[model samples]
Target: MMPRPLLLGFLAIVVLAVLWISNPAVAFAAGLVIALWQKQVDLPHISTVSRYALQGGIVLLGFGIQASQLWTLTTQFAWIVTLYIGVVIILGLLGARLLRMAATEGQLITGGTAICGGTAVVTLAPIIGAKPAQTGAVLGIIFLLNAFALLSFPTIGQALDLNQTQFGLWAALAIHDTASVVATAQIYGDEAA
Candidate 1:
């Protein structure tokens, strides 16, 4: 039998390969399971690899978006987006204060919720002087929410009988990460994506 670390490393590679081709929610769930099962296993460079994979996915998805459609949507809904972000940030900060959370942690979570999830949190963390642990905690929270959204949004859209356009808009507005939004929309159809 292979040494335990080697076996775990091989399993990680296979799972990542599968994840690259599989549906986003399924891939996330599979990774979660593997992580739980091998909590002690340490894979070097996995974080860097995953970060690159996520960036690549985002870039590839960008290629699929029509600039005309994006411009139209942005022009039509810019005010709504601004208002939503403002309200969410205000409420998030208030709630964090009420809960007596750290200021940096609260801001990180609030930014993640009000903006682009992990991207927002990561971008703000350094500027806000967030410690590594605080940033990690906020990221973990955002990731969990993202996972939940990935699994539930498509189902909810189907149950509501949302059309491709409606479902796509809803997912874009409601989901945290771009990856999650695209994945959930893709579940509805290509047009939704």
Candidate 2:
């Protein structure tokens, strides 16, 4: 059997190939494999880098959308968004109950899904005084879901022949994280972004 270092090296090459192919599904699989097999993961450094990068991207993305245009969108989507959020929360609660998840976990999952992904969970967790483990678990769950969404969303959009507006709206409503939504939308097209 190959040693761990050699295995990591081989996987690094594969990761480069996956990125060159620009296939999100392949990228995700490669990333997972690398994460599992790469012994020197530097998790803390990686987390810091990723968090800052994601935050920076979100800020940069905001520049593209005008405040006035955003207001119009809020007006258009506000009521339905609220209703949708409520339904999602209820459904999540029921699912959590059936699955026997902790109340805190359920609430965090619901807030993450029904609102702006981990951001909602993070914000609400502090206000509600959640335990650290609960917050971490919810954040992990949301990130996992976002990774899944980023992997398949573009292919689904293409298969369905959804135009920019339709795909953008779907990404906004369906995706858990702002970064995932933006990445998927950009893959679909700039107009979607």
Candidate 3:
């Protein structure tokens, strides 16, 4: 017999697939809803499966990119990304000091906003001696802001009449996480990816 969570998850995917063409975010939102709904349904294995699936998807997404294109992006955006990292970090440090937040919490939040999102926060968490609760709070705030950006970025792109490169670069520069950047760029079209 199929496990309840897996079965429910499949059903949710099937249902969401119909709406995916209209909005990929709907599928993402649906899956999040499913995970929330499955709180008591052996999430350890389910989450493991989810993580592996995402890993495979990320690998596949990578295969679609060309080395030459990567070089072009590297040359084009390297300095820009570096500048943003420095500025964002410095600004975050100043804001943290101004707000009088706990140093560890502020550093985690800064790492998250300035680098590769949750990965940055998680990487710096142990180094900075942040508690799990602090990590979770930072993640919650970052992802919530990411969700808002994910929704609004397309409109902003259109309003700016941004070309693929411009939109992708903006998303890469402004978005907090890699996933949100990828998703936002994919929306702008394949070239943006």
Candidate 4:
């Protein structure tokens, strides 16, 4: 048998590879199961180091995203961005209520709009008293929507006759995470990248 660390390392790679397969965000929850089975992750006492890493990753991610480009958004597309944000806020609120979530859950969803994905959720957790489990659930839902958007949005942009710049703007403004927006923009064309 492989050494314990080697075996665990291999499993980690395989897990991440599976995650990259782009399945409708189901993989994330599935990953949680795998972690629990392997005893690799401890839900209680989730480390401060891990939390810091998450924050660091988001800040680093901003290096790739030029916030200034958001200004290039056309006057014509204002309504589109507004509608997208509105839908996210409304559905997120409704979903939280449907789940019998507290105010923190709603705050997490709102933070997702104002900032990058998991980063936003983590940051808002302390402020709103959101439990770690709820944060995980919200992150899972966002991951699902992001996966769906990444797979479908580019095609929709083409169907709508959006130029590279237009599509980039839409992706950046409409998508919940900077990573997803960047991925969508890059997939559409490097012109916007």
- The candidate that wins on TM-score is 3
Error of 4 at 133 (Å): 0.5
TM-score of 3: 0.88
Tens digit of per-residue lDDT, candidate 4, span 1-193: 4467776686678667765864423444455566666674434554886567556755775576666654544465678767777777788788878888687867797778645776788778878888889889889977787777777888899999999887877777767786667666667876653
* Local accuracy of candidate 2 as per-residue lDDT tens digits, 20-105: 88655566677787777765654457688778977996899799999998898889878877888889999999999999998888
Candidate 1 similarity to native, TM-score: 0.82
RMSD of each: 3.0, 4.1, 2.8, 6.3
Q: Which candidate model has the greater TM-score, 2 or 4? A: 2
Locate the minimum summed-lDDT window of 10 residues in model 2: 35-44
lDDT, candidates in the order shown: 0.85, 0.84, 0.83, 0.71
lDDT of 1: 0.85
Candidate 2 local Cα displacement, residue 54, angstroms: 1.9
Each model's TM-score, in the order given? Answer: 0.82, 0.74, 0.88, 0.56
**Worst 10 contiguous positions by lDDT, candidate 1:** 1-10
Q: What ranges in model 4 sit over 4 Å off?
A: 1-101
Instruction: Pull out the clashing pairs in model 4.
Output: none
The lDDT of model 3 is 0.83
Tens digits of per-residue lDDT for model 3 on 1-193? Answer: 4587777778777665845574546656765776676555554486688678767867898899889988988998899999999999999999999999999988998889999888898899999888999999999998987887777888889999999999989888888987778877777788876
